[model samples]
Target: MIQAFYLPNVAQIKKRYENNVQTLLKYPFLFRKDFPDFDSLSVQYFPFDDNGYIPFYKNENRFGSYINVNDPVIDRYFFKNLDKPILASDVYSQYQLEYLNDNVRKSEWVGQENHIYLHYTNWCNFCNFLSCLNFKQLLPDKKIVFLFEEEISRYPIDFKKEFGIDYSQYQVKPIGIREVNRLIWHTQLAAHNGGDFFNEIFYDHPNLLVFKSVMFKNIKEIVKNLRRQWKQRGKLSSRLETELARLRHPTDKDFLVALFLNNACACCDNFRFKNSKLQPYSEQYSERKKRKKRSTQKRNDGISR
Candidate 1:
């Protein structure tokens, strides 16, 4: 879960902030979820004086990675409360505001009659949606749709072309048919970290049959598929679930590697790691040549003797 506190409150912020100028300072991208100890991280706003909070500058490292604000009120708040306070200004990028305004608030589409929105806030989620799309999950009477975040253009993938949207057109908008009650949108908010959509978009949906493509959710599906395949092949281990549960602080990569290994094992009757012979063919060949040369030299020396 992500906890964010903005002075003037996010709802009260002006429209310009909603526009999310690339150079402008926005809310921080909290990795607090990444750290269990800092699960309830908050970005409270406190100013040094009544002149309103001084505008902060960009970190230049990456969009919304971190911010450096010099305010006495904020400093004091951090000093007394948490050792390292992540101020609202510190973790903001244009993406944060974009998510808030374009996706969450401008969601008038959510209120439409007989509609189910299949929203993909980033490229990874979009790809996941495409791969795991099951028409049976959607209501036949209701329209099915897709949503994409505009920043998806940054990825090399031709998403617009995929859905028959104009390739040149770029913006956060819905793009899907409405034969009954379905819609699609490109609400590009969370970029590299697609998981953040679970926190940002999932909680507040009202009367809206909203579904965001989540990587972990897809992983669960992949696990089930692999489990069935392995079980069918008589390779399902009783201890497999236990082994997965034993992983401490496992990442998406870890789960993926496990899935891949299980699938490979099921596909191949003789799947085993030969670490000793895992080297590249070129390297192994060179080693063999070196050994042959050494043997030849020893034989030549013996002949001379």
Candidate 2:
């Protein structure tokens, strides 16, 4: 049984780290009441640190160890002295198993084999651009499914109105982190802009198709080429290949840090190289300024006429 402990002041905690609860919500199966082992497993709510770490406790015997979810130093110390620290990514996989077991009998839309799961959360501009590349004309034979981070109604514009493609015609579903974990199991191929969620879920998946922007006119062709190269060489020729390699054999906590730095820009910056080495952000800033100046000059000249 696994027990997670958090501060009792829920509103205050949620306001501080908005995504914290969202992350924890993925483990609902641990608290299920109907399971035969439910009595053995339980979660307790307590008035603990309101501004500090969320704690986790596991009790197999009379004694249990305390783990601070937010403390990296503690996590490292534990790993070095005791056992490999249970990472958020580790829990992510566990959540998937629990979800699959619970829903195995149900007729929910679990992905199919060789299916392409596009992680379009609608939160990142780059992800949105990648999703747009999955035009119907590109992959007529493949089964393409889109996983959204939020409900369709929350989106400001419909895909039909904005991109001229009716998303309803395709399999588009809003999913939480747990559902995403379950979906990844059935997905043989995936296309994403290197979001953290995707990075964690598909870290071990061998056939991942990562793209930065809409550089090619045909998304399907590009994915096919990448998959071919990946199968032959065990890696892609893209800039993200190095980062992707590190993800495959993630050894320590640095993997998550690397993913964060690598995925810093959802669409714009090629973080694969930038995050690995020292570079000047000012250079990119200056280039943007120059482009803005040129655009402004053209606009001013047009207005003067």
lDDT of each: 0.32, 0.31
Q: Point out where model 1 deviates above 4 Å.
A: 1-6, 9-225, 229-241, 245-256, 262-305
Candidate 2 lDDT over 1-305, as tens digits, reads 22333333434433423332232234321121122121223222233342133222234233323323323232211112111111111221222223323322111232112222233333232221221121323233323233344432322333356546453233312121122222222332446544556545433232231323223346455455543454355333333445445455433233323322233333333222211112223456657757978999999999999
TM-score computed on alpha carbons, candidate 1: 0.16
**Candidate 2 similarity to native, TM-score:** 0.21
Error of 1 at 43 (Å): 14
- Models 1 onward score TM values of 0.16, 0.21
What tens digits encode model 1's per-residue C-alpha lDDT throughout 1-305? Answer: 01333434434332222222211112122111121111121221222233233222223222232222222222322112221111122212223322222222111232212112333454332221221122222222223233345532323323345534342232222211111121343354557666555534532322132334434446677765654554343344444444545666544444445554344333421222221111112355556656978999999999999
> Which prediction has the highest TM-score against the true structure?
2
